[model samples]
Target: MKGLLFDLLFYAILIFACIYVLPNYVIQRTIVDGSSMADTLMDGENLYVEKLSYRFDRLDRYDIIVFYPYGRDNTEYYVKRIIGMPGETIQIIGSDIYINGEVLEEHYGKEPIADPGRAAKPITLGDDEYFVMGDNRNISKDSRDKYVGNVSRENIGGKVIFRVTPLNRFGPID
Candidate 1:
């Protein structure tokens, strides 16, 4: 009986490490805060964001990313899709997204953007910056805003790997 108890305790610690400790370095669980990423990631939806790959890799366009916009000290995070990569120019004209004068094709937006916002004019990203936007273009507070501008590569925390909540919509985030 004592041996069984020891095994249980061992397993409990291992499980705890996997659920809590390991995530600090490898992955984390975050929830969608608003309707910004709507249609793709609904408000209140849970997501498993992975940090391992991005640690030694280059981010690709269209990848969904999470970042600490208010500095790493604050806990506030924003999740958005990468629309323009480093060193590229981004602009929005009449509800269309353009990358260096080429129309960017995407299917995630909930509706046509009513406010072009700061993206009305071409904005160029530096070598270490990225332009991000939410799927719900009309209402998302993303890279278009002055404060939110192009997210620096260092501010990006991880990429969304999958959704964990609302069992009916479980699996990969894409």
Candidate 2:
């Protein structure tokens, strides 16, 4: 009877670790809720976000990340691609993105940005701040918006690593 009880306790602990500890500390599942990341991550698609990478390596530009917008609690999370990194100046002029006075060459945007939002003038990032934006430039509420300004390092939850839903589009997210 004691051996059976010990086995039961061990299994219970393992189940709890799988259900709670893993999701909270190592990796988590998140669903894209809007078209902000379209042409890359579609709305309603399931994704696996790994929390381990950023803890060890520095976040790189264009790494799609999930973060809590300033002034928001954990209840809300926004997914955006990192544009301006720490200690960088970012400006959007006439549909062109300029980083530190040079044109940023990238093909992630679905179309030309129709609105520069608060990026009409050069915005400098602090040591731990990052400027982010959505692929659907015109309609996304990203760092350009007053409410969703620069995302700090602490607010970043994790980097999106893979897409799990819609079997046809299942693969690693670039």
Candidate 3:
């Protein structure tokens, strides 16, 4: 009876971690805070963020990521898509995004950017910097804004893998 009780207790702890702790730490969930990523990730939708990937893999262009606006300890967070990679020149002219003088071909931007803001002029990213922007350019406060600026590698928390809520759209994110 003693041996059986010990085994049951161990299994229970393992099950608890697999169901709760692992998902909370290794792969956390975040709710879309705003319409910044409209059409791509809707506001209030639940999405899974893979924390392990950021530690082992490198970030690529167009990958949706979540980060703290001020720092990792801050409560306010923002989700945006990578636009300009490390050491690349980024600029926006007449609602079009140009990377190193070449116009980027992407269908993610929901509408033509009306206000270029700080990115209206050419800005070069550092080796450790990445420029990000929201799909809904019109109202997004992203890298284009002076305060948001370019995101460093450490500031990025994780990649948003997929939407888990709103049953109809449950699947991997594009």
Candidate 4:
């Protein structure tokens, strides 16, 4: 009876560890801390990032993503939208984004940003690089900042698949 009880306890612990810990290896949780994605995503909102989404498919424009800021802590991550794709030349003039010399049509910003800094320059992305920016251009610390430059494809952690917190706002992230 003693041996049987011990075996049962061991298996119970193993089961608990597998069910709880294993999922974390594939999925992660994050909270929006700033106004970078304002109007699109609010601050303090809880989100689920799918770490495995990009392995099989190429990331698309306007796909909100989480990636590490270059040269920053590996565990530190930032969320932004893909504005420029591989091999594309991107330029920001006033409130408009010019891609390959054509103006991009996006309706997420509330107002046209006047000062986009160096991100305003026409930059041609590399084969494995992506240009990102925050929906709240006036307040987000994004690719326009020299410190948080273009993110490498490998640095992209995952896609913001859903928002799970603030019960009223729970739904698939657009």
Candidate 5:
């Protein structure tokens, strides 16, 4: 009878651990489904999103982040990179990103591609808004797309620190 009681207690503890502790402490698994992050993140790659770092530090340029957009429903989330920050003017001209009237030299993309002319007009981000773009400029529907404009700080979920799937392709995201 005592053995059975101990076994029940152990099972209860295990169940509690899975239900509460795991979700709070462990990484959440997600899969990249679109070509938006191409050349940097491939389609169908499994990823472990890190939720701990952003809570302690400020996000930086080139950081790959995940954010919930303003519309199109609550179930979907968008992933992109931080390009233009608050109080900066962002413009896309001839496939290059210009911040505050200066050309940004670093390129994560393999080749130069024309802007879709979707958001050809220059946009100045609000103090709490961030401008994001996909590395795969040609294929990605990102900040350049009218539908997904500057992302507000409130909608940002977290920054992605690494990729954990596809076995051989797993590593830190640039």
Candidate 6:
């Protein structure tokens, strides 16, 4: 009976770690809530966000990330692609995005940006700041909006690495 009891307790602990610790610190399941990343990540799709990579490496431009807008205190999380890295100046002239006065070459934007928003003028990022935007540029409220300025490294949750739901769409996300 004592041996059985010990086994039960050990299994309970293992189950707890799998259910709580892993999801919180390792990889978590997240759902895409909007069309901001359409044609890349669609709404209602389930994704696996890995929290380990950013701990060891710096976030690179074009990496899709999930973050708490403003701060972690806010419940809502925004997923966006990093456009401008730390210490870079970002500005949008017409439909082109300029990073440090050079036009950024990326084909992620579903359509030409219709509004420059705050990015109409050059915005320099701090050492820990990153400028992000949605793939659906015209409708996405991202760094261009006053509400979701530059995302701080601390507010970043993790990188979206895989798609799980809608079985046909299951694969690694670019």
Clashes of each: 0, 0, 0, 0, 0, 0
lDDT of 4 at 70: 62
Worst 10 residues of 1 by lDDT: 68-77
| Candidate 4 vs. true structure, TM-score | 0.86
Q: Which stretches of candidate 2 lie over 4 Å from their true place?
A: none
Give lDDT tens digits, candidate 3, residues 43-152: 99999998786768788899999987688878788999999999999999998999999999999999999998888999999998899999998999999999989898
lDDT per residue for candidate 4 within 44-97, as digits (tens), equals: 999998877586789999999989986435678898999889999888887888
| Among all candidates shown, the one with the greatest lDDT | 6
21-85, model 1: which lDDT tens digit per residue?
Answer: 77886899999999898889999999999988897999899899999876677888899999999
Query: What TM-score, over all chains together, does every model reach?
Result: 0.88, 0.94, 0.90, 0.86, 0.82, 0.95
**Candidate 5 vs candidate 6, lDDT winner:** 6
Q: Which ten residues in a row have the lowest lDDT in candidate 3?
A: 50-59
lDDT of 1 at 136: 90
lDDT of each: 0.90, 0.93, 0.91, 0.85, 0.78, 0.95
* Candidate 2 structure quality by residue, lDDT tens digits, 59-93: 99999999999534657998899999999999999
Best by TM-score: 6
Q: How many clashes would you count in candidate 3?
A: 0
Off by over 4 Å in 4: 1-24, 71-73
Clashes of 1: 0
List the pairs of residues colliding in candidate 4.
Answer: none
Colliding residue pairs in candidate 6: none
Candidate 3 has which clashing residue pairs, if any?
none
Worst 10 residues of 2 by lDDT: 70-79
